[model samples]
Target: MPAEPPVDPMTDRELRADARRNREQVLATAQRLFAAQGLGIPLDEIARRAGVGPGTVHRHFPTKQALYLAVAIDQIRRLVDEGEALAATDDPAALFTLLSRMMASGAENAAVKSALTAAEFDLRDAAPDAAAGLTHQVARLLDRARQAGVVRDDVTVDEVMAIVAGAFAAIRHAGADTSPERSAHLARIILDGLRPPSRR
Candidate 1:
């Protein structure tokens, strides 16, 4: 009999699909657990919640810090995607709309807040590539709004980001008594201040 080609237990496509699913499951599980229990939660617990073995989790992320950084990187990447999408819009008010949406969502995003405030993970150093992309997208969006006369002509991207960071910080520190409506109202107030003198 002609020698049969070595039979692979799993095809390349199947292996890739399995890896993809495992990665997604790990991320989702980690995000949920971290948000509920804080970033101090262990990797094995995340693996348990993800229904994957500890080895599997390590195979994907290698370390808890790696997983945490991955989560933060993913969040930053998503913000960049959103910023890019809004930058493509013709609406003069799209920039503030994006800010409003971010503020609203920030109220519920504990994992991101933790990542931002964490001393252990310096996101700027750890994910410089992703951070720079996000910064560029945000600057592009602000420029679009400025050129449309929606935002102040003198407002720079760094200044705008500083304001946004403060606003998100406020939202993070706000008591449970503070409603989402109140958060939106506060965000709108900031947005109002960002508008051109003529628009105010």
Candidate 2:
């Protein structure tokens, strides 16, 4: 893989914090490596670049697929974080904001998503709690949007999720990976349907 920035060196810390920090470094490193070089990058290489012991990576992720799933789960967790932040805001269009963030995040990691699919690792199955939390956040914002007459009243959380999935597919179909501008445009076009007819 091409040389990227090295993971920050582990600092003097307690064991628990050290372990958490190390695992985070590994995930962040693995996510980047997989994104840059695909899933074929070696675990040892990931550990080397992450500035952690090889055993650390293997202990947390015994298989490449495990690491890939972890990366996907990490992405969802970040989205959930964004969703939570939006939930705290009084913005009436927060739902759209959250959805746009989700779409962009998905576009950014479309390669890992493809690898997960090839490995038959569905994130909902692999990390149900994280998946449910994100959906819950989306549903909360969506209810607020509907009440504010921003989103259509008929759309359910399931439909919202389906739309996200469809956005990923459309993004992939257009080969927008290298073009963030094109990806955002596609996301806007798809997510616009969630708005009430007049708003759209």
Best by TM-score: 2
In angstroms, how far off is 23's CA in candidate 1?
Answer: 0.6
Q: Compose the digit string of candidate 2's lDDT tens values, residues 1-200.
A: 98998866765576679788899999999888876777789999999999988999999999887887888888888888999999999998999898888877767774334422333565667787887888899999999998999998999998898787777778878988667899999999998888888987
Looking at model 1, the pairs that clash are none
RMSD values, in order shown: 2.7, 8.7
lDDT of 1 by residue, 1-200 (tens): 99999999999999999999999999988877766676789999999999999999999899887897787677767777887788777776777876676555455555455444444566678877876776687688787888888888898877876676677766546653147777777778777889877888
Off by over 4 Å in 2: 1-13, 111-119
In candidate 2, list every pair of residues with a backbone clash.
none
